[model samples]
Target: MATKYAMLARTSRLQSVASTEELEEATTELQNFTVAAGTLIKVASEQSAPTDDLQVFVYDPVLREPNTTRKYQCAQDSLLPVSDDLWPFIVSIPEPNRRLQLVQDSSRCNWLYTAMPGDVVSVPARYFDRDDFRLFECIICYIGPVPEIHPVGYFFGLELLDDVQSPQTADISFTRKYFECDADAAIFITADRILPTPLPQDEEIESANEAPESSWSLTNFIQNTVDSIRASLPL
Candidate 1:
């Protein structure tokens, strides 16, 4: 059986900036500060809307314990306003659309039930076992032997946020392993309330087997023809 996981990380403060340029400047400054503090910085989104500038969420990997000293220092150094209410959190849910029930000893936060656009969720990568990879691929890409139009080319991040042990933190080695394995367990942003695509029945699989075989044969034939032509025209 496939296991799903969820994590929550509190946002200590929300810094509102005047413009996009200022937001970028603030993000860069925070990134540099993390680097100076010997911590890895994980930026959730590359593009930010004007409203997103209302809160700049920074995940600090170095500070494992829940201490406000460094967080305060970082906020002070960056000159960003810190919100008194630290209830807002970024929650990562593995399976979407399913009602998330609180597990015993599990981490909790304010936005545990709601999913935001920039929220990072984990899914098994393509490098996993054939069945597991196909399961996720069918759900995420939606191009598994179906003639109907489906979404594709969704990007994933090669880093797993470890919020269980330490809230809103990830180890450098843990993040590196994803890239090393060609992204064994990559994280993706939830564009909407995503749900897993149902697996095809046995009869459906039997019918689709021939298509793949034909496709493979045609690909091999093209490659062989190219090789033959190259051999004949050898200098």
Candidate 2:
């Protein structure tokens, strides 16, 4: 379960900044949020074609100046805001809408819930299965078969509240191994809240090496990864 502290706590806060001004508003909120330890952040988005570039800048508000910002080729996709992944909570772009997209699951034959733009979603780090590489694929790639349109990309992070024992850490590492088998197929992370990035044709070799150990090829990997990740989360 997520630890929800009283808003009064000076170091426990969460907010979503949709604009520069909104980001400024997060200052006070950040003060209240006690950066939780053992946080794992999974940010996924598509990269536009090479001809088109996407720019994202991060400001260290405390300094009133920007830090070393990164610019990726339109075809490049790397984890943005590569700051500490864990936090007591999150302050992200877009906001949450109570509404969810409903889709029929052919395998399960049940309606499942998915995130719309502005949805700040969370899941336990333990819920991910590293073996099938399904978890990693879903988090990093959206090429899976699911037909539902994701209004925006997804950003997720976990804040570990208590002392995690060695077994739990082992389990997490064990889960990561399943993902290591593919090691390629364009598994990349983006900083945007919406899906605008695209995998570059030039990076094809880099991506291919990242596929999972399972029977998934690039096509299956995309559909399966997107569908699986969208389905696995608790909506």
Give the lowest summed-lDDT range of ten residues in model 1: 141-150
Q: List, residue by residue over 55-141, the lDDT tens digit for candidate 2.
A: 322323333122333221211222222222211112221221101010111211110123222222222333334442212213332
Q: How many collisions between residues are there in candidate 2?
A: 34
- What is candidate 1's lDDT per residue for 130-217, written digit by digit as tens? 4544223211221111111113212223233432221112322243332332233333333222333333598678786646534657
In terms of TM-score, how similar is model 2 to the real structure? 0.15
In the order shown, the candidates' Cα RMSDs to the true structure are 19.8, 23.3
Give Cα distance to truth, residue 68, candidate 2, Å. 22
- Candidates in order have lDDT scores of 0.30, 0.27
True-structure lDDT of candidate 1: 0.30
Error of 1 at 124 (Å): 4.6
- Winning candidate number (lDDT): 1
